[model samples]
Target: MHNTALQSWGDSFRAFVHPRVITMLFMGLSAGIPILLIFSTLSIWLREAGVERSTVTYFSWAALGYSFKFVWAPLIDRLPFPVLYGLLGRRRSWLIIAQTGIIGAILWMGFTDPAQNLTMMAFAAVALGFASATQDIVIDAYRIEAADADLQAMMSSAYIGGYRIGMIVAGAGALTIAGLFEAEGSYEPMAWTVAYGCMALAMGIGVITTLIIGEPTVTRTDSKYFHETSDYVRFLLMFALTVIAFIAANIYTANLTNPLKSGLIDAGMISELAGFIAGTLKLAISVAAAILTAWLTTKVGVTPTGMVQETYIAPVKDFIDRYGKAAIVVLTLIGVYRIADIVMGVMANVFYTDLGFSKEEIATVSKTFGLFMTIAGSFLGGLLSVRYGVVRILFLGALLSAITNILFAIMAHLGPNTMMFAGVIAADNLSGGLATAAFIAYLSGLTNISFTAMQYAIFSSIMTLFPKILAGFSGTVVDSVGYSWFFIGTAIIGIPVLFLVVLAGRMMQINADKQAEIETKT
Candidate 1:
């Protein structure tokens, strides 16, 4: 049995010093490095290169890799890496592979000139996104497997701390380096190249950590499907076919809907809204096609069917079994929880640059100082959750998150006032940190211990999918109605999320009551 006793604040704080928790910090740093490179930092790079706003926004789609990583997660979990597995064991071997990919992708992006060869830059971004997402998968698994349940909360905190530190390095550090390389009043591609090259070099920290760390001792059960080479090969082939089918279906549906989408927009429907509708439809069609392909594969043999059932279907079924009708509500809350933050965040660098802030100014206020504010908020959030409860804190987070957008709108009107910029960053990062802490606790609570890893992966993927999709159109929204209105719109959209949080809180309370009653009866 696991310990359910709550620790005193002193004990809880001391937990961070554990060796395993410290290891997770470095693991998280490794995981955090590539994300901003593909989003905020990359946005700054593209704008400096004279890439169109709409095009830069489109590049945000590269992060769809993170949102869809669940698709290949089972393979990462079960597949044996050829020679490395023999040398380094399962988790470390994958970590090294993923770290290597990140380095190569970052270096590739560094070398590509976005203005001269936008397509090449995009390809590199996509590769980096996928590589980074893969690293996330492996690192998350490693975090869980490497520690006991009692220490998870502490490990998670340490991971977040390390992750934020890594972001500081990527965000402010990259910007400072780029600014140093470039002369004032002019954009030089070489400056960016040098900055990215430094970022790539920074990945060595993760690689070295992976090399030094010992693998978790996992007790393996002999499963014929995973152990046999033939079954693994067959499953891989089927998975590949399913992916191909999804891509084909997505392309076909997108092409077919383009005319209708254009007509709707031309007929005065909001272009952003129309694009969303079309994209959602295409996504549904693609998913259906993939499912059909998977079903067809089942007819050939039982192995692929079993793999699908175990990898995807079973965890979903388990969730539904636990939550029943309320499952949809929980999933909705997860999907929309971060919309206010993510959608606004995608364009933050662009907004700062447009408002006449230099790269150095933006880096200092927004990334460096803001990082500490976020960390402070996270600590406060964690403490508050222990005092009040996760649900109440979650609601507070949602409310504060929505309210902070109004600050952004105010700042938009204030132009590039440095004080106003700093004030806004403080409020936003604090709320963001608090919300993140509460939200992570809520997600962890929802997982069935039996399916902890897989279920968490699915939940995380759902969390980002909608937000990222909307973020991809942020530039379009900004272009349509300017930054002030765009900021206000983001705030308004968050209104529904506040209500959803209340509903979710009530539902969880009811479930807790019922569980308590059942336990009493037993």
Candidate 2:
């Protein structure tokens, strides 16, 4: 008999050659580019433009869009486009809408000079973030529904590979291009604008993929609409409510800021009653607005004449019913699992920049080589997950992610050596890749096929939201404690996650074994 190893290799290779798999790879690139733009790529641009580190850190909140995606994910799940849905089906129609919005927003970001118009830049970033998050919701649902289990593993691998490649191009490639422009006698501010403009053009790849691909037919519990035109009404309600909230907030904040408010309330402190009043009233209005939005949308989205179940409601209830109180454990662990890596990530590029590593060096080492390491690690994690279980891999990933922070702490003292940087980069990227793979597999397992978009969106949103919150403070930590201690603290924070991961793993395995035994008996 031929070697077993060669047979396994052959089978794995065959998984990569599918046409749909190839398309996922391209789409992965599309999905990956926008994030780095809002996260690291934008940070680099900000640093180049003499933007303050704290400001840049806060700016990362643009990615809060990813966290809030669950807010509108239901509409994406069930609502059809007015005209586009008839042409492209549900997934592709939403994909097109998201893509168009992303492209326009990125272009808008490019046109606004951050050095001159930081407020407008932040607004553009928010717009880009929302659009990117929307695209992600649809894209994720597409991948989950595209194929069966084996193919999903294959597709996920391809997607990660493509995503890593996109990260490299956006991170390293963009930096290098900007560096070239800098050498060509261009100012840093202008150079970054050009870089972002090109990044927007890169979105065309996703747009074309949307046009050519076939949308997967989703099976929904509700085949009946509230009315013949109820979806349209619900859509209008969401849109109108959103517009009103924005206008109201804008008008209120404008009024508060202008009344000769003594220089915008001194950086971070709110000394004036007007400022405080506006903030409190805004928060109250937002709550009332959410309640109103729910009531109105429920009326429009659900049947008025008979007993009706809404798309968003049942999926959540299904999740809660399945997990009971254990759902808290799952969600909390997910929220914390990536915090060590993600929190450090906000300051990572800043660290490299401060450490006196040139953009070119960072591109070459931290990004280009880092991409390959992450992809390799991700593929390995995916395989291990299939062979063993997501729980084991998940626990291992959490442990390793925490430990890797120690390596960064060491590097903090070691200082600017390419050799050590390469070594640490390899370990860090590998562990992060493994964790990401395991996490995705776990999330995929959690989703109900009928409500994949809503459930997965919920999972993905919580996954990022907590870490983004903690990461928002990373700049403050570094500023106060310095990078070395900040990194050490980051490492220390992972201890709680390690325990949570182990606990969740044990609980999930026990449940799985019990279910297996029940099935066997049946």
Candidate 3:
């Protein structure tokens, strides 16, 4: 009887371990590692090493990787890499390039000393961020394209599970290294090197996974027509645009020179770094304009007519029919959640320190406690999605996310009692996890096999842009207004999302009715 029970359990576990799901897990890890390295973890390491707080805060700009992913998204969407394309096909070729860059950048990070070569470190971090962002675009596309509509929920659940696990390793593990490196008053470099090395190795899992995973079959219908065009024309247009944009960007670089160089000089708010900030902005604008031009080519063709006509042939115009309602809800919730979290994040450590909580206490409660809560939320959300349907669960998760942001505001006003802090962190993280899982599942369901990679990349990229732009000024806001108001504002920001959620739910209802009407007519 014991043997039979054990066998049954093993069988059940095996049934859930689909190869596509396993691939998503590794891809998620690859996607997640560089995120912390470039943003939070990098900030922590710099501050600990006696870098200026402002410089550490400013380095947050490197996260433009997540925001500007839409810029190169078209390339991954349409352009085949010359060397890798022949071997791995269009999708997997870019995946291999991105994964390799991620590993290389991490290794470079391990070798550099912030104290000696902070400029190089910033560049390296940007490289890692870009590679990571690129990897995310391809992996998201693959996960969507590789699976059927029904299987997408499970794939998303597995992907989030992997991403959360990666976060644990990066966040908790890096801090543990920092703590271990601390002796008396300072840190030893060994801990950072080891931590970075491990991250590089972890990224390698993506490189290996790319080799094993099958490329999605890309029919002409699958790839937008913009992809089939001459590479020389695309390259020439991009080059011409790059020249015009670089001139404006150079002015920004000139302004930021002092601030960028300040940690090495003195930390008196080097007014010079303003130029660099401006340059980043200019470059961002140029990249956006170029990417938009590339993306526009797809909609100009008669293929859209074919898709419209073909709609009459299938059961409800094929499962690939746009789920515009779900898309809006998912994107809105994503925008709100990230904006709330990030807008709060820049000031969070400063708030804790101000409240007289020691670094060790903050680390223990926030990182450790938040981790488990998030995990619980993710697991529960996955189970709920499979049981209750992704759309319903997504709506509930978004509502919960809004509720918890309010809870966080209350906690912020109440002061830093350990128990209350832990409570807020738990609630916030759980809601975040639930929303993340649900949102991923919802996005996955909307992707059609054709245009799978490009459309999914576009959606994922869309979701990141607003939050990232808003988060850039989080520090400026907190510095100007103070903490309590900041938290309250963050919480209130969720109100818009609640309305978006209701709108999305109604839209989904309309779509379902329309789909049903079409089905009956056929």
Candidate 4:
């Protein structure tokens, strides 16, 4: 029986390498490229153009759109786009809109000068970020939904592969272009325009993807069929609650809602009442979830039985009951990898400048080599995960990422050698690319399709949260400790993560055992 299960595992791994799975690698690149252009790449450009360091630092706040994307995730989940929705369906519709917005934002920035219209540029960039975040939400949902349970990991790998490619084009490619134009110090227009043009070209991949990849089948909605009875009842109940809340507030404030509205024509109490209701709803949902988890566990031996055979076997959920630690390993490793990268990233440009590398020089070598390394790393990592297994690939990826950080530390200490700098950037991006694909595949294995968007968002957000916080202080850290020590500190931060990965490995084995036991019992 154990041998049979092993055979099944082997077959599953083999099946993952199919052509459908292969396509996701490029899709990942498509999703990834424009992100840095609007954010990190933009930051470097601003800093180079004599924008105040303080202002460059504050511009990071524009990323709030990403952190808060869960707010509009439901809208993307439920609301269809106007004209585009009819043609591309919900998933593709949202993707096209967001991608179009990203292109427009980039083009606008190409034409504007931060020195003359920094405020306008800032607004345009925020719009890009917001659009990018929306695109991510939809792209994630589409990827998860497009494949069956058996294929999600492949999709994840593909997305990462594509994403790394995009990053290379946007990050390193942009830098290289900037160098070409910025050589004479009179090439700001050319540099910025080239950077923006790369984004425009990168969006072509997404457009092609939109054209080629068929939309996932959606549950058809009747526009007005549910409105008469069930919808009206729900509306009335909601309306009743609103009225009662308003009355209660008015009574508490001695009829302030009416008097204020009459005197100042101000809309009163609605916002406060909405907040109160929202809090109550959140609390109620939490309680219901707790109750449901307890009830389900009791019925299913505290570990669910039966695989949810959809697009792919959700490795995360499948192992959650049987191999608890394996799930932790995947999450912790992903978090550590990203956090380490983010911590070092914010300080990288400043480090280059301080080390006497001009913006042009930094852009030329870093982007050209770094982009290719990242793409190679992601592609190879995905190949490895498919050829080997998640655990092995993860172990290798974590080790590579940790070692690469040390490489950067070495480069920092070695002083200003462009070749050495290129080497460090290449290694760093390579590890980053590999780790990203592996991590996404690992995370995808854990999700249930029903909660695909929400779960992925949760994982992606948690991973982003700490790293972003640490990154926020990257400038300050570099300012205080200098570059060499800062890179070394970032390297050291990976130690706990490495330990956590080992712990996760043990958990995966335990999960495998538990799963075997269930198979026997059934």
User: TM-scores of all models?
Assistant: 0.82, 0.78, 0.75, 0.66
| Predictions in order: lDDT | 0.83, 0.77, 0.68, 0.66
- Candidate 1's C-alpha runs over 4 A off are 1-6, 40-59, 86-89, 110-122, 147-154, 175-194, 214-224, 343-363, 386-389, 406-420, 448-453, 467-522
Pitting candidate 1 against candidate 2, the one with the higher TM-score is 1
Give the winner by TM-score.
1
User: Model 1 misses residue 182 by how many Å?
Assistant: 6.6
Clashes of 4: 24
**Residue 361 in candidate 1, Cα distance off native in Å:** 5.2
Top model by lDDT, which number? 1
lDDT of 1 by residue, 1-522 (tens): 111345577766665677887887788788888999999999999999999999999988898878788888777776878889999998889889999999999999999989899999999999999999989888877776776554555566667777898888888789999999999878899999999999999999999999999998756433335767787888888889999999999888877789878988999988877888877888889999998888888887735666777767777898888776678899999999999999999999999999999989997999789988987787667666654566677888888988999898899888889999999999999999888877876777776544545677898989988898889889988998999999998888888988888887677667667778989999
Comparing 2 and 4 by TM-score, which wins? Answer: 2
Q: What is residue 216's positional error in candidate 2, in angstroms?
A: 2.6
Error of 4 at 21 (Å): 5.2
User: Per TM-score, what order, best first?
Assistant: 1, 2, 3, 4
Clashing pairs in 2: none
List, residue by residue over 1-522, the lDDT tens digit for candidate 3.
Answer: 001112233332442477887788777777777788887888878877788998888787777767656545655655668777889888889988888888898888878889888998888888888788888888888887786654566567677777777877777777676667667578666678888888887777878888888887545454323344464354435534544554455455555543455543355542334534544555666556544443443245423433223222232233335564455564565556456655666667777788778888887887777777876787566656665566666767767766676665566577768898888888878887777777787767665665555556656766666765676666777767877677778777766765665676677677777878989999
Worst 10 residues of 2 by lDDT: 1-10
